[model samples]
Target: MTTTSVNQDKPLPGKPGVAPTFRWAILTLSLSMLLPALSTSIVNVALPSMAEGFSASFQQVQWIVLAYLLAISILIVGVGRLGDIAGRRRLLLAGIAVFTAATFLSGVAPTLWLLIAARAAQGLGAASMMALSMAFVAETVPPSRIGRAMGLLGTMSAVGTALGPSLGGVLIAGFGWRAIFFVTAPLGLLTFVLARRYLPADGPTQKVGRLGFDYVGMLLLALTLGAYLLAVTLEHGVFGTLSLALLLAAVVGLGLFVLVERRATSPLVRLANFRVPVLSAGLAMSAVVSTVMMTTLVVGPFHLSRALGVQTALIGLVMSAGPVVAALTGVPAGRMVDRLGAQRVVFVGLIGMVVGSISMSLVPVSFGIAGYVTSLVVITASYALFQTANNTTVMTGIRADQRGVISGMLNLSRNLGLLTGASVMGAVFAFASGATDITTAASADVATGTRWAFAVAAALITVALGVAVGSRNRSSSDRHD
Candidate 1:
C-alpha cells in the first residue's frame, strides 16, 4: 500500500491523548453506539401515539418494536462477519447512511407497515453499528485505555436507554410522534459525516485460513434467534401452542446451524474457538448478568405501584434511577477494570449483584421506595462494573480479525438474556404471586411475588459467579499444565 493509504488506514495515535482528531473520532463512534440504543428506547414511549396515528390496535403497533429488534437480532452476527471480510470502516459508513435515511423514512411514512419496514431497515444499520463500533475501539484507543473506551460506549448506551422516554414524551406531546423520529434523524446525519471524515479508513481485508463466508450458518442462526425471540416475547410472555412450535423450530435450527458451521469452509463462527475459557465464560456471564438486570426492569415498576402504592405517574421516575446509576458508574467501572484487572473486578461486580438481589428479596413493602431504590442502585451500579469489566476482557482477549464477529456474539448474548428475562422473569413473578392475572392481584401477593422473583435472580447471579470463578481457575490450571 502507498504511504498515504497506510496513513489513511491507521487508527488514532496509540498514546490515548486528548488530540482534537482523536476526540472527534471517539465522538463519532459514541454517536454510532448511541443512535441504535436511542432508537430502541425512544420509540417505546411513542407506541401509543403511533397506534392512534395509524388507527391500529395496540397489538399491531407493538410490531413496530418487535420488527426492529428482530432485524437487529438476526443481522448482527452476519453483518459483523461481513464487515470482517469486506472492511469495517467502509461498511460502518454505509450503515450510518442507511440508518440516517431510514430514520427519515420512519418519520415520514404514511402507513404503519411502511413505518415498521423502515424500523427494520434501521435495525440493519443498527446491527452494523452495534457490532463494528466495539471492534473499532481496539483499533482506535491505546491498548491500555480500551477499558475506558468500552466504558464510554456502555455509558452512552445507558444514557440512550435512560434519556429516551423523557425525550420521546416531550417530542410527542409537543410536535407529535413523528417528531421523535425527526429529532434523531439529524443526529444520525451528523454521525455519518463525522464517521466518514474522522474515523479511520478501512484497511485491506485480512485473509484467514478460510477463504469464503458461511452464508448457510448465518441463515440458520438468524432463523433460530428470530424464532426464539418471537416465541418468548409474543402473547404477553405466555407460552402457548404457537410459542411451543416456535421454540421447537428454534432448537431445530440451532442444531442445523451447528452442523452447517462444522462443515463450512469459512465458518461464520469457528465453533472450536468457543473452547477458549475467557471468551466462553465472558459471553455466558454477560447473558446471565443481563438476564438479572432485566429482572429489575420487568419487576420494579409493578412492585413500586402494587406493593408500595406509588402513583402510576411516578413509577417511571423510580424506574429511571437504575439506568441513571448505570450511566454514572459506567466510566468509573471501566477505569477500575483497567487498574484492578478484569478478573478481580468481575467477581466484585457479581458479588455486589448477589447482595443487591438478596436485598430485593427481603425488603419489606413497609420500607417503601427508599429500600427498593437503594437495592436497585446497588444492582445497577454493580451491573455497570460487571459490564465494563466483562466487555473489556472479552473484546481485548480476541484476535483482531475476529473482533467483529465476537462483538456481535457478545451483544447477541445480552439481547438473548434480555429476551429470556422479559419472559422467564415475568413468569417467575407471576408464578410466585400465585396469580393468573397479575394486574388484578392483591398488593401483598405482588410484594410476595417480588421477593421470590428477586430471590431467583440472586440464584442466577450466584451461578454466574461460579462461571467466573471456574473460568479463572481453569485458565490458571491450563497455563500451569
Candidate 2:
C-alpha cells in the first residue's frame, strides 16, 4: 500500500525534501494526544500508594481519578467550542502549560485535597489537548494523509494507555507514586515548544463574535453533561434516588441548553448538524463501540484471577494484551482506511468486532489465557481500525470552522462511554456471576460472568454495526436523490 506525508498534497512554501515543518507539527499534535491518554490511566496504578500516603479511603482515593474525569467530561465540549471561537493553537499551548504545571504540583502537593485539585487542573489542560489535537490535524495535515495522521494520533493514544500502568509501576517502585506525575512534565514542555513553533497560526478571519460566544448555551450544556456523568457514575453506575435526581437534573438542563442554543447568536453545538446522517451515526457508534471495549477492561482482571486462577502479579500483564494489540494495529489500520475507503473499512471493522465479541463470550475456560487474549486482540485491533476510519470520516467531512467543537464532541462521547461501561458492564459482570461482589465469586461463576458480559458486549457491537449500515444507506439514498 502507498503512503504519503502531510505535505504531499500541498508542499510547505519553505523547504524541499525536508518536510521539517510537517514532521514537527505532527509530533506536537501527537504529544497532545498522548499526554491526556497517559494521564487517564497512569494515575490509576498509583491509587493505592496515594491512599496510603494521604491516609485516605478507597472512595477518597478514587476521587483522584474521578475528579480528572469529571473536569474533562464537563468541559471538553465547552473547551472545543471555545477553541473554535478563541483559537485552537493558542488554547492548546495554554492547555499544555497548565498540564505541565499541574504535573509538578501534583508531585509536590502536601495534602490529598491539594493533589486532587491539581488533578482537576490537569483535566482542564487535558480537555483542551484532546479536544483540539484532532481538530488541528485537519489544519496541518494534507487531505490525502488525513487517515494516516488520524491513525498516528490513535497510535499515540494507545501507546499512552498501554505505557501508563507498567510505567507507573516502575516509577512507584523506584521513586514513589509522585514520580508518575513528575515524569511527564518534560514531555509536556517539549510538546508546548514544538506546537508554538510549528503549528499554523489561526487566521484573521477566525476571530470570535461572528456569532458571538454562546456563554449561556455553553454553561447549560456543561451542567447537563456533568449531571448525567454523575448520575451514571454515582454508586458505581447503579441508579438510586440521588442518581435519579441527578438524571432528572441532567434532563432538565439539557432541555434548557437546547432552548438557549436555539436563541443564541452562536451555539456551542449546532443542534441541526445532527441531521447529517454520517455525523450522527458516527457519534452513536463511537459511544456504543467504546462501551463494548470497556467490557474487556472492566471484567478481564476478575475473569483472569477468579476463573483462570492467574496470579495477582500477572493480572495486569495479561490484561495489557488488548492495548498492546491496539498500539500495534493503529498505523496499519490507518493505512487500510487510506486505501480501502473509510465507510468500507468501518463496516469491516464493526463486523470484526461482532465476531470477536462472540468469541469472547464463548471461549471456554478450558482453553485458558491464550483463548482470552486471542479474542481480545481481535476486538482491540478491530477497534483501532474502526476508530481510525470513523474519526477520519467525521473530522474530514465537516466544515473547517466547526472542527474543534466536533472534535470535542467525539472525545466527549468516548469518555461518557467509558464511564458508562465501567458502571454498567461491571454491574452486568456481578449479576451474571450471582455474586454481590465479583472479587468473591467462585471460579466457575466468574467464568460464567465473563461469558455473559461479553455476550451483552456482542449485542452492543451488533447494534453499532446496524447503525453504520443504516446510516450508510440513508446517506447514499440522500445523495442519489
| The candidate that achieves the highest TM-score relative to the unseen native structure | 2
**Model 2: ten consecutive residues of lowest lDDT:** 11-20
Per-model TM-score, in order, reads 0.95, 0.96
The parts of candidate 1 lying over 4 Å away from their true place are: 1-20, 206-210
Cand. 1 TM to true fold: 0.95
lDDT of 1 at 3: 11
Candidate 1 lDDT score at position 305: 84
Of candidate 1, the 10-residue stretch with the lowest lDDT total is 1-10
Per-residue lDDT of model 1, residues 1-481, tens digit only = 0111222334464323323265677778889989899999899999999999999999999999999888888899988988888888888998988889999999999999999999999999999999999999888777777787788899889999999999998999999999988999999999988887777676767544356777788889999999999999995577999999999999999999999988888899999978999999999999999999999989988898888999988999999998899999988887888889888989999999999999999988889899999999999999999999999999986887788999999999998898899899999999899987888889999998999999999999999999999999999999999
The TM-score that candidate 2 achieves is 0.96
What tens digits encode model 2's per-residue C-alpha lDDT throughout 105-162? 9989999999999999999999999999999988777787889889989999999999
Give candidate 2 regions above 4 Å deviation: 1-20, 205-211
